[model samples]
Target: MSQPEELLDESLRAITERTVELANPGSGRAVAALRRLTARRRTPALPVVVVGEVSRGKSTLVNALVGQRVLPADRTVTTSTWTLIKHGPSLAGQATVQCGDGTIETVPVNTVAALGTYLAVDGQQQLEDLHGAGARCVSMVLEVPSPLLESGLQLIDTPGVGGLRATHRQATLTALAEADAVVFVIRPGEPISASERLFLAEASEQIGTCVVVQTHRDQTLKAKAALDADLASLTDRQQWCALLGDQERADRVVAYFRDVKGISVSSRNALLAQDEPPGPVRDTLLRSSGLQMLTEVLQHDVVAARRRVRQRTELQLVELVLRQTRDRTRETVALLSGDAEAARILEDRRATIGRWVAHGGDLWRRRYRAGCARIPDELQVIVDRRCAELNTDVGRQLAAMKPTEIEKAMKGVLGLPAQVFTELLTEVDTKIAAAAAGVRELLERDGLAQQAHQTDDDGVTFERLGDGTFTRASTNLSVEDLKHATLGGMAGVGIASSGALVLAHAGILPGALAAAAAAGTAGGAAGTGLAATAATIAAPIFWPFVVGAVAFVAIHQVSRVRARTREQARTVLATVREEIAGTALTRALDAAKEVGRMVEEDIEAGIRELHDEADRARRDLADATTLTPAARLARISDAEDLLARVEDLRAEAAALAGRI
Candidate 1:
């Protein structure tokens, strides 16, 4: 490293260490960003994306540049996903598949051609079927042992957009958006398409540099000239205005694209000449291929541009850390003097936040209550519909069933209420999540209210709680318990059997009330006796009139029993809705209250910290007053040393900024 690089490294290390020592709550994100910046400084790479229409020689150019046939090239739209090529100790390849649920899977591959298996439509379909809907092939990674990749140059080969689907165009555009620089390859015989021209115009706005390459120079020189003329016309402001349909932007874009440098290269000749000894024939082949000029342009333009971007990013991060440190130092200095004005401002701010805490709690409660008020009615509608549907279906079945079959069919309908309760529970969960989100939004808004005070003031602000904290309270109920409760409640109503007496004894419901409700809903003892008699009426032993009377009585009693059961089930559901809604609202309010308490506690902690700082300042003042002359001189010397260190860091930052 040179003097400037060494100086920058030292300054960044100091900033990172100082941030760690300060350990301010708000500094966590800043510290993490600084660490990443420091790591990037250690191993910086310039990302260059190779893009073009199908069969435009993008992959061929990349293979020639790397001096290895690592990327597969063909006449068709061969590349299907973005492939990042980098330097490794040895050749390696991997494919990264992103599933619909935001999970990533890495599949190792043995050859570059094998990558197509993952990127192809058939492969994607298989993956989708395996991973379920919305799964896709995201991107691929390839590592090669190449000299160009070793010197901090990363080349990305992208899918061709020409003659392909609109999705391919979108994927290419997305790649271009993140590229540091772009290489647009064109064939000699074809003029730039409308899509390519539009893409170039958009790339001009997003990327720092773009270089055009005219491939297949082995073709007629006249064809190359024609392509060059076409490109020159495309860059003209008037043509761009016609192509892009924006006057002011056309002017800007034309200026950017006008001076874009283009080089002609035959990748075929370049690849063949790589193994030949130096001679006139070799020189001629390399010159005609234009590989030498391309290398020089990449080194001078693309590499330098990347360096500038990296330096600027590093400078920004350093300045952020410096500003934070200075702010903290200023606060300490104020505390050292035990400033009465500072104490009064802090107290006033604390009082303001306390008022917000109280008011916000009440506001959140009102909003939560109002949001939950509609849930019961919504649940009632669902329950009523489900119940009516069950009744109609059961009534039709009863009309057709013989006497012996009636009891068996009616048992199935008894379990229908469990399904309704389950659906209602799902709806309740959805509402609770919504209510929790509302409460969270309210808390966040109040949290940001302190930002205005922070601009002209210096004190700790409340950190907003995480999402899990707000949602946990409302989601405490277990689905299994709900399922069991619904089933148990249905079984107690005697729709299936005389087992209702057993459920009553087991105290699933209050004993006498359970017995009475079950018996009444089951059409009383008379109804049960009629059903028993009807079961035997089908036997040959029963007389004809007796069988007829039993059948009539059994049908009538079954109807009466079903009607009573329907009304009782509706009443039970209504009660369940009230209980569940009440529980959800109570949990929501408790969560809101917890948030308010946290805010109040955070403010109180800030007040205590300020008081402690003031106390330390008082002690320091006393010590200074009691210091001997020799001790005072020593203190002055220490202060001078710190001042010199500060000046040195400031000059280093300025020099780094100039480099950026």
Candidate 2:
């Protein structure tokens, strides 16, 4: 079992440890997030700071509680610096203060108040210079009041706001932020002044408690009555009850408090009347009305503060889990996209491989046929030469007609149907436009609207976006549009015109001339052979020669047919290339476009995981609590599921990258 105060102290310690873990420099996200988390109700202590008009005894309260008059309380701007008094194990300990020069000064306990003096005399030429320097010139420290070591609370004292001569009001406001609870002290009959109300609203945001105190109640009984009456006059009775709380309405011109015991006393008279001063004068006075009431109220305030701190810590943990889940989801989506892109690239290359095979086969066949086809044309040219050399009338007519026939054949062979090519290219244009439109939609999905390739009046152009996607207008396929044309037309002309010329030239001589040549060859005319003329003409050059001519004509015919075949083959090849390229482009675009969708999907999944983990962690945290000093110390450990969630988020990131 633990005491009430001890339990509170243990809870505070646990909160601080958690805060430290969240602020750890080793954790990238946690370190950055700590500022946002801690900015909201991070402190665990009940801040009780005393404030009053100049020479109205603000530091006196601090000195009384500390059981010493060590704090300067003279008439001439005493306690010029903002001093922070909090509980610690030792009175003299490490204190960190931000000096007026934008630097931190670590000093001992006693010299903490000297920060203002140091800046005023040693560095700043005048009080005005302090205003120019800002909070960097101010110092922060955990001033250990030995009396408060067992109290587990803090007390802050600030200079007067209304009558502190030549001080920056901003500086006073800045100093006031260090306190969690403020005791606003006023002279009798001053009833919640306008300045105090304004101060309360501002301080309420930074500090947890806002209390009003009317000091020097014993100055006059009449004055005490007047104070109560004036408070009623200044504010609506109902509102006053709200600010001061319904409990403290009985006390007039006393050490009044909200939600805690209030007391009134003439402390000055009590101390002076005692002939022998107690060894600890400050301690004796602290037991008096205002200070004693302040302590009691502080204890109550500490309880509420602890609850607020716990709630805030829980909110922070939840936010951390949500953010981590979002990040993991994004990573997973990217991984999937990358994997899909890789697969698409492989598929595209395979298509190119198929095209390569088709084109190579066509070229091989065309080359093989070309040689055989050339023989007939050459033979025909030789026969024409022999007839022209004889200068016969028939030979002359044949020569003249041959040139015209050759010319006509050339014209006919070269003429190609442009309609077929035009239609094919138009089809290509339509399909390309469709692809472009589809890709644009995907780009827009990824919030990459700028990457859309445009076909607007400015002409077709590619636009690039942030996500590494590019857009281009569909290419046209005119004679210039022939990005993938090859050897089809040339093969057509060679086969068509050359074969016709060879056949025409071979049949030039009549059958009677053919018979005379055979007789001459059989009689061995001119000793060409031991055979007649007919044998000479027909024997050596007989069926084998005819066969050779026929083979040449066959090759030429085959070559002519291949001309159209080549064009069709190239068209097929182009279609194949387009299919492969279009598929790849579509896949890549799909992957890129779907990134946001993937992220959304993964985030939902991560949220589910986080919900489960958080529930487990909350249960574990509750179960681990024994609410005893020994047990609390032992069980105050990190949530098991929280640690696992962090690991899970990391693993999710890796998995996402891999899948992509």
TM-score of each: 0.41, 0.33
lDDT (C-alpha, whole model) for all candidates: 0.50, 0.35
Compare the candidates by lDDT and give the number of the best one: 1
> Least lDDT summed over 10 consecutive residues: which range in candidate 1?
468-477
* Clash count, predicted structure 1: 0
- Model 1, span 39-83: residue lDDT tens: 445456666779888778888899899887767676332424667
Residue 268's lDDT within candidate 1 is: 85
The deviation in Å at residue 294 for candidate 2 is 3.5
Q: What is the alpha-carbon lDDT for the whole of candidate 2?
A: 0.35
Which candidate ranks first by TM-score, i.e. highest? 1
